[model samples]
Target: MIAKFTPVLLFFGIVSCYNVRKHKDAKVPGNANDYLDYVLSLARPIIASSGLDPIFPLPEVTGTFENTILGVHWHGNVALYNGFLFGLSTLTRAGDATLEVVGFRMDFTGDVGLSNVQAGYRCHYDVQGVGDDADINVLIPYVSARFSSSTFLLNTTTTMNSFQILNIGSPQVTFQGFDGLDWVAEAIADIVLDNLGEEILEALESGISDILECIISVTSSDDPNLSIDSCVPVRNVKVIRRN
Candidate 1:
């Protein structure tokens, strides 16, 4: 039913795993390349560890679908479980080390049931529908991001640009075992899955924002007088979704 799944779990999955700290062997970055390398080294763990297990499973999700032309409406709950997002790896710098990317792969399963459903035109009808199981998987080969710096008032401010997902693969979203009105169930499922790509991308973008914030913190940690605020603007992350 117009899936509109926000994927709050996906965002926190990466953010919760982050532990920003300078390695014992860490040295001050002398150049742009060095700075990026340093950031990557610090970011590896956060990316690799995100959603390795069913840390967050969405239960009791409610949604609705309505088609005025067909005079059909459905409202119900979807319980998503066994949510696992893994295969986050192969983080590397793009050409000239100016752009960076991290791999992405995720899958989840859920139970769907339209406890209250209604369909009508000239004649009105209502019934309960059950969608037994749903399995969703997505593969975005890589998410690329760029970092830039500008000096103002003798303060070098680092800014991270929006991220782009590359080589986006078709997502696999399927629904099975509907107890009533096969076409209605399919229509409802379709509405939900249509927004999956955008929602997933938003979640990953939030994770990247956290990584950049951590890097800023660790980079300036060595100097007590320096704080992340001085070198990075508030909420330095901004992502623009691209079709």
Candidate 2:
């Protein structure tokens, strides 16, 4: 419950209770952000990223939550898939959440299963960047704190739909000692990033291509209802490279 808990079952279909916490609102992105759809690619689809939020984890969600639902308690947290530790290919937020995030920290316990330890995945190195004009606007779980469960806690200190939007005081991520096995957790992050680095890059490229195509298509479309001029150029892109 961030604003008003509507039984209308909107925004994650929460049929529970919540108190909408109000904070200093941001410059609510213009519908212009929708133009990011123009940068879409089939190899990497924004819709794919859309399917990621609140499922509970990195590149999907970055928030924290604690509440009782259906008369049962639940807890969950998320972290970004940076080069250091790996849980996902790229850091992406599922673009379909009602509550936005500013910034936050999350803790983990038990087996996070964040990496593919079987392979020798470890910090190899990676670099990625997103352009400023490429403004991307998606509802993402920014701030979160959880142990090991399936509930999202979003933090909204500063929000960014594209990489350029990130700043020194943007969202913060942490995966601490879990089940007293800090070493194990560290190992997993390394491996996941090492093994999946290339894959992640490919996916990102595909996704960007798709967004671009979408914009071009609509711009050239015969439908008067859909026009390129209507698209607000929104791009949240990151470039990750490792040597």
Candidate 3:
């Protein structure tokens, strides 16, 4: 009878060991929300320490505007320089996301340009003057982006799936020139936006990609399993704006 019971006890012991092994080999459930949070959290500190936020001393821009009002010719040439961009913020949402879909909104502000302007009105008398130190404020609205990522073995890469400009904010330009005529300032602002819009978006994308690359590189350096080089490309990204 003791020999017969020994076989049953042996079977139970073998089954228990197999169950433990199975549990050990099983993969943990993936949590994309946590993944997003972790990476973004790491990014903030890295960006702060690296001094990548609040870009300053923007490139200078110049434009000229001419028009005929009531047969009186009006013209001006202006230059804007020494701009700064700040107030960078990201809009986060509360929801569960898969590894395939991650989205967020980015917003910032720019204080651009002390200007030097030369304007004149010609009809009967010549009115020529120079204005100094114009004030301009650029309000960058929220831009939404959708990104996707995949991990194979120890490598991971993120791609910019899509982006949209929800609203385009107008720049405020105050040029105390032409004896209180603000239209020149407005025209100059329009020109600035046309060029600066593209530049700002490009800078933003590059900056973000660099931050992500830094995060991955630092993390991979610490973990042997994730040491492989990975690229995050954000090129040729199209923008869709709301009508």
State the C-alpha lDDT per candidate: 0.35, 0.27, 0.41
Q: Identify the leading candidate in terms of TM-score.
A: 3
229, model 2: CA deviation in Å? 15
Model 3: per-residue Cα lDDT over 130-157, one tens digit each = 5544456655543444333333212323
Model 3 CA deviation exceeding 4 Å by range: 1-30, 89-97, 101-129, 157-179, 216-243
Assess candidate 2 and give its TM-score to the true structure. Answer: 0.24
Superposition error at 232 for model 2 (Å): 16
Model 3, global lDDT:
0.41
Candidate 2, which ten residues in sequence have the lowest lDDT sum?
Answer: 105-114
| lDDT score, candidate 3, position 103 | 19
Model 3 lDDT at residue 161: 33
Candidates by lDDT, descending order:
3, 1, 2
Q: Candidate 2's residue-wise lDDT over 1-243, tens digit each?
A: 011112122321221122233332212122212322222222123333432211121232122324455886544332333322222222323242232222221111111011121112112211122111111111122212111111123311111122121211121223332332343334334444333343333333343323433443443233455543333334454534323
Ranked by TM-score, the better of candidates 2 and 3 is: 3
In model 3, what is the error at residue 130, expressed in angstroms? 3.7
Q: What lDDT does candidate 1 reach at residue 190?
A: 53
Per-residue lDDT value at 230 in model 2:
33
Cα displacement (angstroms), candidate 1, residue 158, comes to 3.6
